[model samples]
Structures are given as structure tokens and as C-alpha cells.
Target: MPKLLLLEAMGNTGEYILDAARHLNAEIIVVTHEDVHEDWYSPTLKAKIAEYGKLVFADFSDSEGALRQLKELARAEGVDGVVAGWEFLTPLVARLAADLGLPGNDPTRSLSCRNKRIMARAFTEHGIPAPRTVAARDLGEAYTLVRSAGLTYPVVVKPSEQSGSWGVSVVSDDEELADAFVVAQSHIFQMPHGIPLDPHVIIQEYVGGTEFSIETVAVRGAVTPLFPYDKFTTGGAKRAEYGHTVPAELDAAQVAVLQEAAVAAARAVGITNGVAHTELKLLPDGTTRIIELGARLPGDHVVALMRQARGIDEARIYVQIALGQEPVLTPTADTAAGIRFLTPPRGGTLRSVTGLGDCDAVALSKMTVPPGGRVRAPGDNDSRVGYVILHADTAAEVNAAAAQVLANVSIEVV
Candidate 1:
């Protein structure tokens, strides 16, 4: 069996990667910190690892030390490929892959895929259509930069390196800027692995438009853009992703426009192999602006959604690329899939959730938190109580089904 090494196995992507490994009959070994494995891993994830993979401990915070250990392990085990399981570890994965003479991204430009500060610079350099952004170390500096750059009110403020929309906020005026900056810089170290993050924060001109995500799979510098998806987010001062529908309602020409921009963004970031998840906004003027792109699989169960909607397993494709093999990109299904997050009405102890039984199109529903658990206020993605997956024959059908669930589902919190 071919051996594969994954840098970490604690996120949502880990389970999908494990399932893909089984499909390929590959022996997948997960390398992670011991504390992370013990603290962050769920029971289901732990069981999956035990049954389908092996575990190796390494301190990711010690970058040089971890690289040395991973290099030795990759050689000792004759590992055929190396992949990253989290956004924070993408740079490390690229470096490791290059060190082993395997197909991977350019280590020099890998940071641009993770850090917004560097990403903005890369977009500017490549002439990629993106928002005007400025990084700030303090609120005063952020204000100065915003005014100096001619950025008006109602701007976006977010951490340079965080993911999942954590610490992302929209400031309507200067008074809210201070608190937004504090929240953006709150998390200095990423959980589980304790990876240090950039202390600065990025404030950008708000790109007003409809948001969508397009994924691309690159093999040896050749890019193949996949179906675009509608990215639904909550409005107001804070942006939280509420859901997404695959094969976003668009004509052939519209899809072409998005695909071209996404491919350019991927190339600009030096993604010669693996996948790129590019989030862009379709403006009212019919132009597209890239919000950000990550050199990893589209998160939030998008891999599974793609499989259900298009009969394409993105997780499997990622593994194939890591193994330096051609990926199967043909679509076998003309369907649609969506996921809606369950956000409580208020921040309090969970009581009970009901009304899901009446929703017919819900293929699967999962509650992340149990009864009596403390839930946060609905401002960001962290406030989600659970999620429901929906699948149907078309995007409209899936969207209508999701609407019914969102309208009927009731969660009583106090």
C-alpha cells in the first residue's frame, strides 16, 4: 500500500481525508501534537484515526524541529505523499513536500495563501482584482491607513491569519474600529497545535456584491476550476457564514468569468499542485473581486457537498494530487447540495431544538453542542448550534428546501 502523511487530523477535513484514504487503499499516517490530539479531537475523529490511520507526535510550534522530524519520518516510512489538514499548516506542508522532492506549492509564496496581509500584496502584484487593503498594528494606525488610503466608513476588519471568520467584523464608523481591532488580534496562538499567528490585522474597503466560492485543482501547474457555489452570509456589522449552495445559480458566461478570476488567483499564489479555494464577490457592475483564497480544500463540508451535488469527491482529488497522479475531474451528477447552520436566537444555555422532523429535504442534521451547553451570541461562525445538509435535483430545489428548514426549525434557548 502507498503511504501518505497528513500534517494534522483535528479539523473537519481530517475525517474526509481519512475516508478518501480508505477509498484509495492507502495507509494514512497523521502527524500532530499530543496535546492537540488529546484536547481538540472529537470521539468520532479519534475512532476514525484508530481504525483507518496511525498517529505520530510532533511539536508544530517548533518549526525547525518539526521539519527535521517530519523529513526523517517521510523518508523512513517511504511516504508517497504529504498533505496538510489545516490552513495554519499549509506552509509547512509545502516546505515538507519540496524537501522530499514531491509535487507541491512554491514555499516562497505559500504564506500569501494563509496571511491576508501578504495575500493583498500578492493580488496587487499580480494585477488580480481584489479589495484595497491595509494592515495595521494598532487602532490609531488602522485609522490613519484607512483615511490615507481613501477608505471610507463601513470597512472590513479581520485578523491577518485566522480562519472560519473568527474575529472578522465590519465597522460602520471610527468608534467601532478600536473594539474590532482588539477582537481581530485576540487570538495570538492557534488552538490544538499552538501555532503563532501574525500579530497585525487587516482592514479593507468593503467590496459590495454577492459572494461565491470557486475551487480549483492544480496538477503540475495546470489548473482546473470546479463548479462555483453561492456563499450566504449574515448581514449587519458582523459577517457570519450561514450556509452555501453548490453549483451557484449562474449561466455559462458567468461561470466562465468566475473561473478565470479564480484560476488567476491560484496561479498568482504559486499553487502548482493541490487545491485552491477562492472566495470572490460578483459586483453589481458584473465584475468580480477576489476576497481571499486559501491553498487548501474548501472547508465547511464542501468536499462532501461536491460529492453529493456533482458526483465528484474533492477530498479524493486532493489525495491523488499529493500522490503526484492525475485527478478525476469529470462530473457524474447534475444535482445540488446545501448546508445551513443552526444559530440560536440568543446567547444562553441550550434548551431544546424542534421542528426538524417536518423538513423533508434535510439529508442529515448534526448538533455540535449538547443540551445545557453554553452558546455564544450569534456574531460569527462560532455561534452555530448545529447544521443540516440538504440535497436535491437542482440549485433552486435545494435552496427552497433549505429555506423551509430555516423557517420551520426552532431552537429554544434561555
Candidate 2:
């Protein structure tokens, strides 16, 4: 059995990774801050860890110190592989794996995968198709840089290092840009571990197109790109993802465009091994731009959706890649799956949510928020209150059922 070192199991991806470990008969040793493990980890994750894994506590805020501690622990544990359960820790994972003489991404360029400013520079240097982005330390600098970049209004202002679209906004003018800048600057650190973040903000020329995601796997520097999926995000200033359809409805040529962009991005970011969850935009001009990429598994229960749709267990594949084993990518089924988030009309105190009808295609419907919980407006992924997952024989059928299922649902918030 291969022993794996997982750096912080915090999201749905972590849960799925732990569950996959069980099926593979692998031993998992998770490293996280003690406080975060207590506060953020779900009971199910804790139980899974208790069953076949061990937990180690370290202060990730001190990156060097944490790396030292983890290195010693890795040696003692006789770990065979390392995986970043969170995107922010990709750099550290690279460093750890490199120090252990294990297969992993290039440690020197790992920061390019996490910091947008660095990632933009990498893309520019590599000639990767990406949005024209410039970084700034303040509003004045932002204005200067945006003009210098030859970017126009309706630009995107966001933190240099944040996930889930947390401080991202589309601004149409200078005043809106100023407002968005402060919001982006406010995200100065990552929580739970108190990890410091880049103080600069990125002012990027907005790419107008349909967004899609592709999951790519690499082993011993060889890449295998998966099918591109529909990343259904709401368009506006917020760009919150409301739904996702597996096997995005697109022709072979279109899929090739997305997958090529994704693979190029993964390679540019030094993702020589393990998995990359890449997001891209297909412009109206029959071209695509690399939006961003995560050197880890796809988030938002996508692991579940992929399995239901293609019978491709990405979670399992991720584990195999980390262990330097050939990933099992052959499809076991030909189907489709989708997930739609339930959101209130606006931000308010939650009162009630009803009218979720049990349609045949509906596989699971769940409310994550309870009554009286304060809810934010649907601005980002965090604003979601609940979600429903559906499945069918094809993407069209799944999407059709999704529309019908969501149309009948009602959410009431005071």
C-alpha cells in the first residue's frame, strides 16, 4: 500500500480524495493546522481519516517552517507521494515532493500556479493564449498599469491569489474599478492557516466567451487531457457558477480547442506530474484563452459529476498519479451529469426553501444552509445555499432535466 501525504483536506476535493484512498487501499497522512482541522473539516472527513489515516498539525502560515516539519514527518512516515488537497498549497507540495526525490511539479515554478501575477508572467513568457493582465499595488498604479497594458473598460479586477472567485469583479469604469480594487486588496491572506497572500491586485482585460473546464492528468511528464465540461457560471459583475454540465455540448473541433488550451496551460505552469484542473474561455472568434489552472483535482463535486458521466473516476485517477502509477482513464460508462446551485433572489436572512420536486433525473438535492442563516447575494461560489445534481444518458437530457428541476424550486429569504 502506498502512503500519501495530503496537504490540507478542506473542500469537496479533499473529501473525494480520502474516499478514493479507501478504495485503492492506500494510507493517507493529512497535514493541516489543528484549528482548521477542528473547525473546518467535516465529521465524515474526520471519520475517514480516523479509519485509515493519521492527522498532523502544522502552522502553514510559516511556509518554510511548515515545510521543514512536513519533510521530517514525511521521512518518518515513509510516504511515497505528495498531493495538494488545496490549490494554495501547490507550491509547498512541489517543494516537499522535490525534497523527497519523488515525482512532482517543478518546485521553482510552483508559485506560477497559485499567484495570478506570476501566472500571467509565465503565460506571457510561454506565449500561452491568455487575457492581457497587469498587476498593481494601489488604485493609482492600477490605472496606470491598465492604460499601459492597453486594456479597456469592462476589465476584471481581482486578488492576485484567491480561489472560488472571492474578490473578483467586472468593472466598466474608473469608479467601479476603484471599488473593485479595494475589494480585491482586502483579501490579504488565506484563512484557516493565516497564510499571507500577495498584496497586489490584477487588472485584467476581460475575455468575452463561454467558459469551460478540462481535467488533465500527467505521469512521468506525459499528458492526457480529458473531455471538456460545461462550467455554467452566471455572467455579470460577480460571475458566480450556478451549474455545470459534464461533457460540454460541443463538436470535436471545439473540444480540441479547449483541451489544447488546457494542456498548454498545465505544461506552462510546470505541471509535469499529477493532475491539473484547468479553466478556459472559448471566444466567439473560434479561439480560446486560458483563464486559470489549478494543479490539483477539479473542485465543486466535479469528481462526482465526472464519474457519473464518463465513468472516469478522477479522484481515483488523481490518487494514482500522485503515487506515480499509471492512471486508469478508460471510460466505464457513457452518460451525462450536471449540478445546479440553489440561490436566493437576494441577500438576506434565510427564512425557508421549498419546492424541490423529485424528478427522475434528479440524483441528489441537498440544502447546505439552515433556517435563519445569513446569506449573501449570489456573487461568488460562497453565496450558494444548496445544490442539486442530476444525471441522464446524454448532456442534452441532463441539461433539459436540470432546467425543469430548477424551474420548480423556490427559495424564500427574508
Candidate 3:
């Protein structure tokens, strides 16, 4: 059995990775903090990891210490590959693979994949189309840089190193920049592993356009682009994602344009061999600018939707790429699928959810939080209490079903 060491098994990707590993007949070992395993990990994840293989505990906050321990463990257990299920640890994945002499990204520029400032520099160096950005340690610096860089109003402010649209806000004037800066810099440490984070906030030119995401699988320095998907985000100051639809409703020519940009962005980030989840915006003038890209599988149950809609398991493909095997990229199905998150109206105690059974096309509905669970305002991915997954014969049908589901469903918070 081929042994793969996975860092951080607490996110939505963990279940899909474990299922894919089982299908591939590969042994999976999860490395996570002991305290996190005891406190924050859900029973479903714990049981899934336990059934597949062993769970190794470590301190993710101290990268150097964790690297030393992981090296020893890898040597002792004869680990074949290193993969990370979490986006926050993409740099760690690169470092581990480099230390093990395995197929992976370049650790020298790996931080660029996770930090927006470094990412902007890499994009500029490679001439990849991306939003112009500036990093600031405080509000005063941000104001000065915005003026000097000629950045106009309606700029985007977000953490230099965060994902899922957390702390991301679009400000229309100088008066709102300070509050946005504070929100972006509030998160100093990542949860579960307590990994220290960069406190700098990134101020980016607001790229106005339709949003989409593309996943790429690379093996032996060759990258293969997967099907593009339409991304939907909430409008207004906070740009939290609302849902996604697979096999994006795009013509052949438009798909080609997006794919080319995605491939270039992946190469610009020094992604030699691995999976990359890239988000891009298609401007009204037909120009596409990369929002961000991570060297990991996408979150929000995207793998499942992709599999159901296209007969391709991205998680399995990611594992194969990591193990130096050719990934199965050919799609056998031509249908469509989608997922719409159920967000609360406001921050309060969850009372109940209703109208979930009204849609016949609804394949599954999962509520992550129970009744009386305190819910935060709809700001980011964390505010989503549950999601509805749907499938249909056509993209239009799938989108209609998702829309109906969202309309009918109601989340009651007291």
C-alpha cells in the first residue's frame, strides 16, 4: 500500500480526500495538532480518518518543529507522498515535499501562493493578468499607498494570508478604509492548529467582472486544466461566496480564454506538479484577471459536485498527481451540478431550518450547526450553517433547481 501523509484533516476536503484514498487503495495518514483533534474536530472526520489509516499528531504553529517531526515520521513509516488538505498549509506541503525529494511545488516561491503581496509580485514578474495590489501594516500606510499607487475608490481590502473570503471587504471611500483594515487584520492566528499569520492587510483594485473558478492537476511539471465553474459571491461590502455551478455556462471561445489565463497564473506561481484551485474575474471588456490561486483542492464540496457533474474525482486526481501518477482528467458525464449555502439573516441563536424538502431535484441537504447554535453574521464561509446540493440534466436546470432551493429554504435565528 502506498502511504500518503496529509497535513490537517479538519476541513471539508478531508472527507473527500479520505474517500478518494480508499478508492485508490492508498493508505492515508493525517497529521494534525493533538489539542485540535480533541477540541474542534468533528466526529465524522475523526471516524473517517480512523477507518482509513493512522492519525499523527503535531504542532502546526511551529513549522520548523513540525517539519523535523514529520521528517522523522515519514522516514520511519516509509511515506510515499506528502499532501495538504488545508489551504493555509500549502507552504508546508511544498517544504515537506522538497525535504522528501518528492514531486511538489517550488518551496522557494511557495509563500507567494499563500500571500497576496508575494502573489502580486509573482504575477507581475510573469506578466500574468491580475489586480494591482498594495500591502499595508496599518490604516495610515494604506491611505498613503492608495494615493501613491493611484488606486481609486471601491478598493478591496483583505488579509494578506487568508481564504474563503474571510475579512474581505470592498470600500468605496477613504472613510471606510480604516474599519476594513481593522477587520482584515483582526485574524492574527489560524484556528485548529494555531498557526501564526501575517498581520498585513492587502488593498487591491476592485476587479469588476463575472467570477469563475478553475482547478488544475499537474504531474511531472505538466499541468492539465479541468472544467471551469461559475462562482457566485454575495454583493455589497462583504464578498462572501454564496454558491457554485459546475461546467460554467460559457461558449467554447470564452472557455479557452479563461483556461489560458488560468494556466499562465499557475505557472507564474511556480506550481510545477500538484493541484491548483484558481479564481478569476472576467471583465466586461473580455479581459480575465486572476483573483487568487492555491496549491490545493477547492473547498465547499466542489469535489463532489465535479464528480457528480462530470464523472471526474478531483480529490483522487490530486492524490495521483502527488504520488507521481498520471491523473484521470477525462470526463465521462455531461450533466451539471451546484451547491448553494444556507446563510442566516443575521447573527443570533439558530432556531430552526425549514422548506428543505420542497425541491425534488435536491440530492442532499446538510446542516453543519444544530438548533441553538450561535451563528455569526453572513461575512464569510464560517457564517454558512448548511448547504443544498442539486443535480440536473442541463446547466440551466441545475441552476434553476439551486435557485428554487435557495428561495424556498429559510433559516430562522432567534
Candidate 4:
């Protein structure tokens, strides 16, 4: 059996990857910080690892030390491939794979894919159509950059290294910009691994249009764009993703435009191997602008949606690519799927979630937080209480059904 090494298997996508490994009949080893494994890993993931995989410890806080220790493990265990389970460790995975003479992305430019500040510069240097962006270390610097660039109101402020829309805000004026800057700079270190973030915050001109995400799989520098999906987000001071509809309703020309831009963005980030999740906006004039890209699989149960909608196993494809095997990307079905999140109306102690089981269109529903658990305000992805996944024969059917399912669901919070 081929041996695969996974770094930090404790996110929304981790279990899906593990299931893929199991289905592939591969021996899997998980590398994670001991503290994080104990504190952050879900009960289900822990059980899965305990039953089907081996757990190894590493200190991710020190990059050099972690790399040396991981290299030693790779050699000792005869590992076939290295893959990341979280965004923060993707750069490390690239470097480790390159060091071991395995197939992976370019180590020199991997950080550009992981850090927003570097990503903006990469897009600019590569002439990729993206939002006008600038990084600032302080509020005064942010204001100065905005003034110098003649940026208008409703600019976006976000952390350079965080994901899941944490500390991301849209400001309409100077006072709001100051507040947003502070929020953006709040997290200097990521969780679980204590990986230090780029202390700077990014301020970018907000692109206006319908947002969508396209997943691409790159095999030894060959880029193949997968399905493009519609991203439904809540509009306010903070953008919280509410749902996603697979195989978004777009004409062939529009799909081609997004695919072309997505491929270019992936190339710009030096994604020669593995998968790239690219987000972009389709402007009113029929032009597409890149939002950001991750050299990893799409999150928020997107893998599941893809499989249900198109009969494509993206998780398995990712594992096959990491193992240096040819991926099976042929679609086996032509359906549609969607996932809608359930959030409390206000931040408080959750009591009960009613009417979920009554939704016939919902294929599955799972609550991340337990009863009496505290839920955050509907702002970022973290505030999501649970999610429901639905499937139908078409995108329109799935979307409408998902909306109806959400309409019947109610959360009692006090």
C-alpha cells in the first residue's frame, strides 16, 4: 500500500480526505501538533484517525525545526507523498515535497498562494485581473495608500494570512476604515500551530459583481478546470457565505471566461501540481476579476457537493495527484447540488433547532455546535451553527429547494 502523509488533519475537508484515503486502500499518516489534536480535532476525526491511520507529532510553530523533523519522518517511513490539511501548512508541504523529490507545487512561490499580501503582488506582477490591493502595517499607512491610490468608499480590509473570512470587513468611510483595520490586524498568529501571520493588513478595492468559485486540478503542470459554482453570501459589514449552488447557471461563454481566468490565476501562483480553488467576480460588463486563490481543495463541504452534483470525487483526485498517480476526472453524473448554513438570529446560547427533519429536499443536516452551546453573530463562517446539503437534477431546482429548506428551519436561541 502506498503511504501518504497529511499535515494537520482537523478541518472541514480533513475527514473527506481521510475517507478518500480509505477508499484508495492507502496507509495514511497524520502530522499534527499534539495540543491542537487534543483541543481542536472533532470527535469523529479523532475516531477515524485512531481506527485507520497513524498519528505523528510535530512542532509547526518553528518552520525550520518542523521541516527537519518532517523530513526525517518521511525518510524513516518511506512516505510516498505529502499533502496539507490546512492552508497555513500548504507552503510547508510544497517545500517538504520538493525536498523529498516528490511531485508538488513550486516551493519558491508557495507562500504567495497562502498569503493575501503576496497573492496581490503576484497577481499584479502576472497581470492577472484582480482587485487593486495594498498592504498596510498601520491605520495611517492604510489611509495613505487609499488616498494615494484614489480608492473610493466601501473598500475591504482583511488579514493577510487568515481564512474563513475571519477579521474581514467592508468599510464605507474613514472612521469605519480605522475600525476595520484594527479588526484585520487582530490575529497575528493562527490557531493550533501558532503559525505567525504576516502582521500587515490588506486593504483592497471591493469588486462588484456576482461571485463564483471554480475548482481546478493541475497534473504535472496540466491545468483542468472543473465545475464553476455560485457563491451566495450575506451582504452587510461582513460577508458570510450562506450557501453554494454547484454547476452555476452560466452560458458556455461565461463558463469559458471563468475557466480561462482561473487557469491563469493558478499558473500565476505557481500551482504546477495538486488542486487550486479560485474565487472570482463576474462584472456587469462580462469581464471577470480574480478575488483570491488557494492551492488546496475548496472548503465548506464543496467536495461533497461536487461529488453529488457531478459524480466527481475531487478528494480522491487530490489524493491520487499527491501520490503521483493519474487522476480520474471524468464526470459520472449530471445533477446539481447546494449547501445552506444555519445560523442563529442573534448571538446567544442555543436552545434547539427545529424543522430540519421536515425538509424533504435536504439530503443531510449536521449541527457543529451542541445544545446550550454559544453561537456567534452571523458574521463570518465560524458563526455557522450547522449546514444542510441538497441535491436535484438542475442548479435552479437545487437552489430553490435549498432556499425552501432553510426557510422551514428555525433556531431557538436565548
Candidate 5:
């Protein structure tokens, strides 16, 4: 069996990738910090990885050291493919794949896929449709650039290197820009491995309209577009995603537009192989602007939803592409799936959740953060206490069921 080396199997996508590797009969080796595996990983994740294949520990913060160690491990373990289960390590994934001569993206420009400033440059260079953005190292520079660029109010301020809407805010004016900049630059190191991150902040013209995400599977420069999904973000300064509905309710023309934009965005960032999760916004004028794209699988259990709705396993496709094999993109069903995150009304100790059994269409209900655990305010992905996954024959039904589940579910936070 071909052995695949995966980086950081601790996120939601990790389990799905493990399941996919098993389905493909591929041996899997997960590389992560030993402490992370011991501390942050759940019992289920640990057990699953142990049962599936080997687990290798590495220091992700030290990029060069980890790369060298991974090279040695790959050679010794006879690893045939390398994939990244985390978004922040996309560059590392490309570099490792290139070192092994495996199927992957362009290592030379892989940083563009991680850093927003670099990604904006790549998009501009490739003439990709994206928002006009400016990077600033400090507040003074941001103010100067904002005025000179003639950027209007309600612009987006975000960290150059962050995910899940962390440290992202929409500023309505100059007064709000400074606070947003601080939040954007507050993060200095990433979790699990303590990897140092870029301190710079990016200010972009907010692309106003509905937001959507598309997943693409690429093999040897061939890109296959998966079903697009609707992204529901909070309408406020902090654009935290509330949920997602699969097979986004869009007309054929709109779907085509989204697919084309997704492909262009993927190619702009040099995604030759593997999967890309791309986010876009449809403007009022019927045009679309690329918000961002990651050289990894979609989060929020999107892979599971896709499988439940259409019988298509995106995780399987990702592994197949990494293994230099053809991916299965054909959908067997036309159903719809939705997931709604249960956020606490206020930041406090969680008491209990009720009314979980009131929904008939609810397929699975999971409370990630248990009672007595402290919960943060609903601003980013970290604040979600639990989630409800629903499945139905039609998009309306799926949406209705998700809404009902959210309405009935009561989270008591002290």
C-alpha cells in the first residue's frame, strides 16, 4: 500500500481524511507536535489515527527543521504522497511534495496560497477578479494608504496570515480601523505548534453581497469543481460564519459563474494538485470577487455534508489526487445538507443544552464544548459550543430543518 504523509491531523478535516485514506486502502502517517496530540486531540481522533496507521511527531514552528525531519521520515517510511490537513501549512505541503517529487502544487509560489498579501499580488498579477487590497505594517501606514487609495468606509481589515475569520473585521470608518488593525495583528503565533505568523495587516475594499464557497479537486493541472455551498456569515463588524448549506441555491448561470471564478482563483494561486476551498462574493452588479482560497479541504464538516447529500466524498478525492490517481467527482444523489453552529448568547460558563430531540430531519447533533466549559462570545469559529447537521431531499427542507434545530436548541450560558 502507498503511504501518505499528512500534516497536523487535529482539525475537523483530519477525521474525514483518515476515513478517505482507509477507503482508498492507503497507509497514513500523521505528523504533528507530540504535545498537541497529547493535549488538544480528542479521544476519538487519537484512537482513529492509531487504528488507521502511524503517527509521527514534528515541530511545525521550526519550518526548516520540520521539513528536514519530514524528508528523512518520508525516505525511511517510503511515503508516496504528502498532504496538508491544515491551511496554515499549505506552503510546507507544497515544499514537502516537491522534495519527494509527488503530486502537489507549485512550491515556488505556494506562499501566495497562505499569505493574503502574497495571494492578492498573485491575483493581481494573473488578472484574477479579486477585491482591491492594501497591506500595512502599522496603523500610520494603513491610514496613509487608505486615504491615498480612496478606499471608502466599511472596508475589511484582516490579518495577513489567519483563518476561520479570526481577527477579521469590517471597519465603517477611520475610527474603527485602528481597533480592527490591532485585532488583526494581535495574533503573533499559531496554536498547536506555536508557529510564528506574519504581523502585517491587510485592508481591502469590502466586497458587498452574498458569500459562497466552492471546493475543487485538481490533478495534474486538471481542476474539477465540486458543488458550491452557501456561506452564512454574521452581519456585523465581525464576519463570523454561522453555517453553510450544501449545493448552494443558485441558478445554473450563477453556479457557472461561481465555478469559473473558483477555477481561476485556484489557478492563480498555483494549485496544480490536491483540493482548494475558495470563498467568493457575488456583487450586486452580477460580478463576483474572490475573497480568499486555501490549499486545503473545507472546514465545518463540509466533507461529511457533501457525502451525506450527494454521496461524493471530497476527502477521498483529495487523497486520490495526492496519490496521483483519478478522483471520483460524479454525484450520485441530488439531496441537500446543512449545518448550523450553536453559539452562546454571552461569554460565560455553559450550563446545558436542550431541545435537541425536537427536529426530525436532524441527522447528527454534537456538542463540541461540554457543560461547565467556559465559552467565548460569538465572534469567530472558536466560540461555537456545538453544531447541528441536517439532511433532506430538497434545499428548502434542509434549510428549514436547520433553522428549526437552531430555534429549538437552547444553550444556557451563565
Candidate 6:
């Protein structure tokens, strides 16, 4: 069995990875901070580790120190591969894999996969079609740089490195910029490990269009961009991802356009031996803008959705890629699946959610938080109170089923 070191098993991706690891019968070593393992890890995650793996705590806040400690553990444990369970720790995982001479992406260009500031620069250098972006350390500098770059108002303000759409905002003018910049800069560290983040905020020219995501798999520099999928997000000052539909309804030419852009961005970020979850926008004129790429398995339960739609187990493929093995990327199914997040009308004490019908297409449906649980408004990914997964014969059918659920559901909050 291949021994794999999984960095930070915290999200749904972590659970999927663990399941894949068990299926592959790989020896898994999960790493996290002691505090995080106690406070952030779920009981189910802890149970998974207890069943077939070992857990190790490291101070990820100190990158160098953590690297040293993990290096020793990896050597002693005879780890054959390294995988990133959290998007924030992709860089560290790359560095570890490269140092150990294992299958992984290039360490030199790995930050482009995680840090938006560095990723913007990398995209520009590669001539990837992306939103024009400028980084700012403070609001004063933001004003200077944005104006100097000839960027107008209504730009996007986001932290240099973050997930879940946290601290991401669409600002119209200078005052809005100030507010958005404060929120962006306040995200100075990542959770579960307290890893320090780049304090710069990225001001990007807004690209208006339909947004979609393409999940890509690569091995030894060979990239295979899969079909595009619908990535739904709320519109307003804050963009929050509400749901996703797999096997996006697109023509052959349209899928070609998205696949071409996705492959370029994945290779640009050094995804030579791993999986990438890339987001992009398709303009009315058919042009596409690469949003960003993550060098890890996708979160938001996209793994499960993909498996249901295409019968491709991306989490398993990720492990195989890390172990220097070729993955079977063939589609075993031609169905479709979608997930709709239950978003409260506003933020308050959750009272009750009703009207979820037991439809045949509904594969899974339940509330993540119970009644009386504190729930935030639909601002970011974390604000979701529950979700429903549905599968059907086609994308249109799946989308129609999800729409029915959305239309009938009522989220009551005090």
C-alpha cells in the first residue's frame, strides 16, 4: 500500500480523500495543529483517522518549522505520496513532495495555485485570459494602484489568499472600496492551522458573464480537462456560491473553449501531477476569463457530485496521481447531478425550514444545522444552512428538479 501524507483533513474534500484512501488501501497520515484537531475536526473525521490511519500535529503557522517536522515524520513513516486536503496548504504539500522527490507539482510555481496575488501574476506571465488584477497593501495604495492602472469603479475586492468566497466583494466606488478592503485585509490568517496569509488585497476588473467550473486531472505533465459544470453564485456586493450542477449544458464548441482555458491555467500553476478545480467566466461573445485554479480536490461536495454524474471518482484519481500512477478518466455514466444550498432569507436565529419534498430524484436532502442554530445571511459559502442533492437523466432534468426544491422551500429565521 502506498503511504500518503494528507495535509489538513478539514473539509468535505478531506472526508472524500479519506474514503478514497481507504478504498485504495493506502496508509494515511493526517496532519493538523493540535488545537485545530481538537476544535475544528469533526467527530466523524476523528473516527476515520482512528479506524485506519494515524494523526500528527504540527505548527503550520511556522512554515519552515512545520516543513522540518513533517519531513522527519514523512521519512520515518516512509510516506510514498503527499496530498493536500485543504486548498490553503497546497503550497506546503508541493514543497514537501518536491523535497521528497515524490510525484507532485513544481514547488517553484506552486503558490500560484493558492495565493490570488501570485496567481494573478502567474496568469499574466502565461498570457492566460483572466481578469486584470492589481494588488494593494492598504486602501491608500489601492486607490493609487487602481487609478494608475486605469481601472474604473465597480471592481472586485478580494483577499490575496482565501477560500469559500470569504472577504470577496464587488465595490462600486471609493467608499465601498474602503469597506471591502478592510474586510479583505482582515483575513490575515487561515483557520485550522492559523497559517499566516499574504496581507495584500487584489482589485480585479469585473468580468461579467456566465461562470462555470471545469475539473481537470493531470499526471506527469499530461493534463485532461473534463467537461464544464454550472457553478451557481449569489449576486450582490458579496458573491456566495449557492450550488453547482454537473455536466453543464454546453455545445461542443463552448466546452472546447472552456477546456482550452482550463488546461492552460492548470499547467500554468504547475498542476503536472494532481487535480485542479478551476473556475472561469464565459462572456456573451464566447470569450472566457480564467477565474482561479486550486491544486487540490474541490470542496462543496463536488467530489460526490462528479461521481454521481460521470462516475469518475476524482478523490481516488487524486491519490493515484500522487502515487505516480495513471488514472482511468473514462466516464462510466452519462447522467447529471446537482446540489442546492439552503440559504436563509437573512441572518438570525434559525427557526425552521420546510417544504422539502421526497422526490424520486432527490438522492440526499437534509439540514446541516438544526432549528435554533445561529445562521448567517447568504454572504459566503459558510452561510448555507443545508443542501439537497439530486440526480437525473440529464442536466436539464436535474436542474428542473433542483429548481422545484428551491421554489418550494421556505427558510424561517428569527
TM-score, structure 5 vs. true: 0.98
**Per-residue error (Å), model 1, residue 152:** 0.7
Alpha carbon lDDT of each predicted model: 0.92, 0.90, 0.89, 0.92, 0.90, 0.92
**Model 6 steric clash pairs:** none
Cand. 1 TM to true fold: 0.98
Better of 3 and 5 by lDDT: 5
Worst 10 residues of 3 by lDDT: 355-364
Clashing pairs in 1: none
Residue 295 error for model 2, in Å?
Answer: 0.3
lDDT of 3: 0.89
lDDT: the better of candidates 2 and 4: 4
Q: What is the lDDT of candidate 2?
A: 0.90
Per-residue CA lDDT of model 2 for 1-414, tens digit only, reads 899899999998998888888788899999999999999998998998998888999999999999999999999989998988898999999999999998899898899989999999999999999999999999999999988879999999889999898989999999999999999999687997889999999988899888999999888878889999999887788877889999899999999988888888888989888888888999998899998888888888989999999999988888888787888889889899999999888999889888887799999988888999999988888888999999999999999999998889889989
| lDDT by residue (tens digit), candidate 5, 1-414 | 989999988899998889889988999999888899999888999999989879988999999999999999999999989988888888999999999899999999899989999999999999999999999999999999888988998899999999888999998988899999999999889986899998889999988888999998888998878877989999789889989989898888888888999998899899999889999988777789999999999999989989989999989988998898887788999899999999998899999999887677888888989899999998888899999998888888989888777778889999
Find the number of clashing residue pairs for candidate 2: 0
Q: Candidate 4: what lDDT? A: 0.92
Supply the TM-score for candidate 3. 0.98
Give me the runs in candidate 5 sitting further than 4 Å from their true place.
none
| Model 3 alpha-carbon miss at residue 81, Å | 0.5
List model 3 lDDT by residue over 141-201, tens digit each: 9999999999999999999888889999999998899999999999889886788988999
Q: Candidate 6's residue-wise lDDT over 249-286, tens digit each?
A: 99999999999999999988899899999999999999
> For residues 296-333, what per-residue lDDT tens digits would candidate 1 score against the true structure?
98888989899999999998999999988788999999
